[model samples]
Target: MYDALVVGAGPAGLMYSRVLAAKGFKVAVVEKNEQLAVKPCGEGISARVLKTAEIEKSDYNRFISHVIKGAVIVAPNGKEVIVKEEGEMGYVIDKKNFLRVMGEYSASTGAEIYMKEPVKELTFQKDHWLVKTRTMELEAKLLVGADGYLSFVSRTLGLEKPGERKVIPAIQYVMPNVDVHDPDMTYFFLGNDVAPKGYVWIFPKDGRLANVGIGVQGAAPKAYLDKFIKMHPEIFKKVDILEFRGAAVTIGGMLSEIVTDHAILIGEAAGQVIPLTGGGIHTSIAGGKIAAEVTAKALEEGNLSKQRLSEYKDKYNEYWGKRIKDSLKGLHAIEKLSDDELNQLAEILSPEDVVNLANGENVASVAVKLLKHPLFSIKLARALLS
Candidate 1:
């Protein structure tokens, strides 16, 4: 029996395995897909993710696709607000290679990674878990479900899943040779006419290549993306679509309870994603590190009870709970706004306010800003309070 068995080879599982193995734990990771990063994603992460993943600066070029400095927010009326920071803001990565690098690094640290081995069943004995994959039966002292939104292990363990309303459909295309206005900055287009309850994003890589994507609620995501592309001829007229990808994203905040008697949930499986932006890379990396460390401590102490694993939940919440809750509130309020209201909000919000609100910071300042707006003083106040 292994010390820990992680389901899924995504960022969380790989990171968890890497950290645990580095601590001298016997860890194994099982993935359903033959490859990694097959899901559609915006592929953006803040520079802080490097520290959280414990990646070396000398090895960044192995997976870094583009170094981004900031973002451009375009209002419904096409008015633009540019957001920039003092140093490097984020990175657009070659996601497949990034996961592979992390997985290989984990393997080098003594974690066994099994790809294309979809978990078939999970049976709980008194003190350990019997995991059945297609070809073999494995046992583990601790089971971690990082299996993602449709996590089989979570369902089998009777963990609470994110509600359907909290899940959104997203689609993206990898287009090269497009007329990119600024390859250094990612662009966000916001308007109901464009994406209804969601937004359109253009994350550019080197050489004018970009991943243009859309996430929408209560509408066909591909249809909306195509319509947006067709409407923005200035950007898409001559661009060739190199790839099309789609996936379901969880926009819900973190779940209330992620630890069971002898199991733990992390990553998308635990709804640890930013609600308004549907971003999870940074959060997942941080969550994986915390979970692994907590599991390691619990193992060393010879206690695998839920109370022991709850430290992971406590630490993760201490770091991200408020931000996620605020972001979820922000999402609920913004999604209820009409295009006209969004445009008005664009007029009232500054670049700093946008950045702060997006990160679930300075929310009171945002409310104060909205209260100063003659039209939004009461209407949005009620929305925010609700």
Candidate 2:
């Protein structure tokens, strides 16, 4: 029997396994996928994740494809504003290599990894959890669901019922495209026809290659992406499609329940995602760290009950709870805005404040500047005030 069993060997699962094994716990991770990090994402990750994890440059360099400096916001009316990073903002990394390194590092630390194994069922007895796989069965004192948005653990446990949370359909093209103006910059496109309530993003993995994708609500994401490509002839020209992928993102913010008797949830499975920007990498990594902290202490104290494990839930609230609630207030409030209003809001954002918005540092600095516009006075007053 293992002390901990992590389902879905994604970044969150590997991160937890690594930390748990480091703390001398017997940990095992099982992943459904044969290959790692092939999940569809924009790959524009904030350096905040590295900072939160205290990863050094040399350590992070193993998988980085390119370093990002800033971003561009394209308005519905096609107006554009650029936001440059105050410091090293983030990177567009080779995600496959990053996942491989994380998995290997976790295994090297004595954590057992089993790939190509899908979790068939998770049964909680009086004391331990029985994780049944297609090939074998494993038992663990603690069970962690780091699965994707559609989590099997959450379902089996009856955590969030069907329709309790919302997810957006997303699709992307990993291709050799010539016209990303700055390899150091990412781009965001906002408009109804563009992506409806969601947004489209372009993140350069290298000078000539990029992940151009769109996330949309109430429509086909592929249709939106196709239209976006047709709109940007200059960018999509000579685009040699290397890969095509699609997935769903949980944007309902953090779930109300993340823990139960002898079980805990983290990463996307717990809905630990930012509603507005779809930026979950940093939060997912942070959630894993939080899970490890609580998991280790519970194991040490020999208290695997949910009453004791509730410390993980409480601490995560102290850390990310307010941020998620506050950000959701802003993200959901914006949904009432018309496409023209969104364009106006984008127009109101100056370069300096745009940078602040991107970093999530003192957004009030931009809000104060936004008050100067009469349109902002009418439309975004409620969102900014709250």
Candidate 3:
């Protein structure tokens, strides 16, 4: 039996597998797809993710498509607020190559990765799990579910599938040879008409290439994205669609229970995503590292009980749990505002305030700023402060 069986060979599974193997544990990662990063994504990530994943500068540059300075937040009425960071803020990565390198690192540490092998069934027998794939069956002492939003492993764990109320549907087109206003800066468009309850984003990739996408809560995302492209002829005129795909992102906060006896859930399966921006790349990478550390301790002690495994949740919470909760609060507060209110909010919010609020760092500063506006009363400000 293997020390751990990791489902889904995405960044999370591969990362933890690498860590476990490095710690002298036998780990196996099984993936459904033939290749990695086939899922639709904006592929944007902060520099912190690279540090957390322990990738060297040369390897990181291999998969980095663009260096991002910051973003331009546009209001409904066409007003724009430029949020610029002092240095390299983030990167739009070539995710396929990134994941491949991660897998290579994991494999080098003696972790077995099985691709194109979807998990057919999971059976818990005694203290081990019998995982049946399309071609073979394997048994392991622990099961790690790093599978995504529609994770089969999550269902087996008796967790509720992310419902429409908990997820936002997003669609993106890889537009090559497109004329973007600024290739180094990302763009965020905010308006109910533009994306209903969600927002639209234009993240530039390499030269003349961008990922243009729209995420909406209650309507068709592709239709909205297409309409936005048509209306913004200055940006999307003469653009060629190289690829397009749709995906659902879970924004309902992390699940209360992510660990059970001999099993753990990480990545989007457990809602390890930023609720406000639907960003999971960083959080998931961090979570994978934490899960590996916790699981390794449990193995050394010969204890795989739910209580022992629960330490993984505690460590993850200590790291990013509060930030995620705060982001959910920020999302809730902004979702209640009308387009006019958002426009007013944009005018009053400085770039630093936007950064702080999005990161769930300085709520008091933003609350104070909002209180000056008559639209946000003492009650709303208090709500934000709380």
Flag the better candidate by lDDT, 1 or 2.
Answer: 1
Regions more than 4 Å wrong, model 1: 161-165, 379-386
Candidate 3: regions farther than 4 A off: 161-165, 377-380
Model 2 lDDT per residue over 131-202, tens place: 899898999999999987988888888877778778988998988964876778889988888888888899
* Alpha-carbon lDDT, every model: 0.88, 0.82, 0.88
- Tens digits of lDDT, candidate 1, 14-60: 99999999999999999999899988888888888888898888889
TM-score of 1: 0.96
Residue 357 of model 3 has an lDDT of 75
What value of lDDT does candidate 1 attain over all alpha carbons?
0.88
Q: RMSD in Å for candidate 2, one decimal?
A: 2.1
Clashing pairs in 3: none
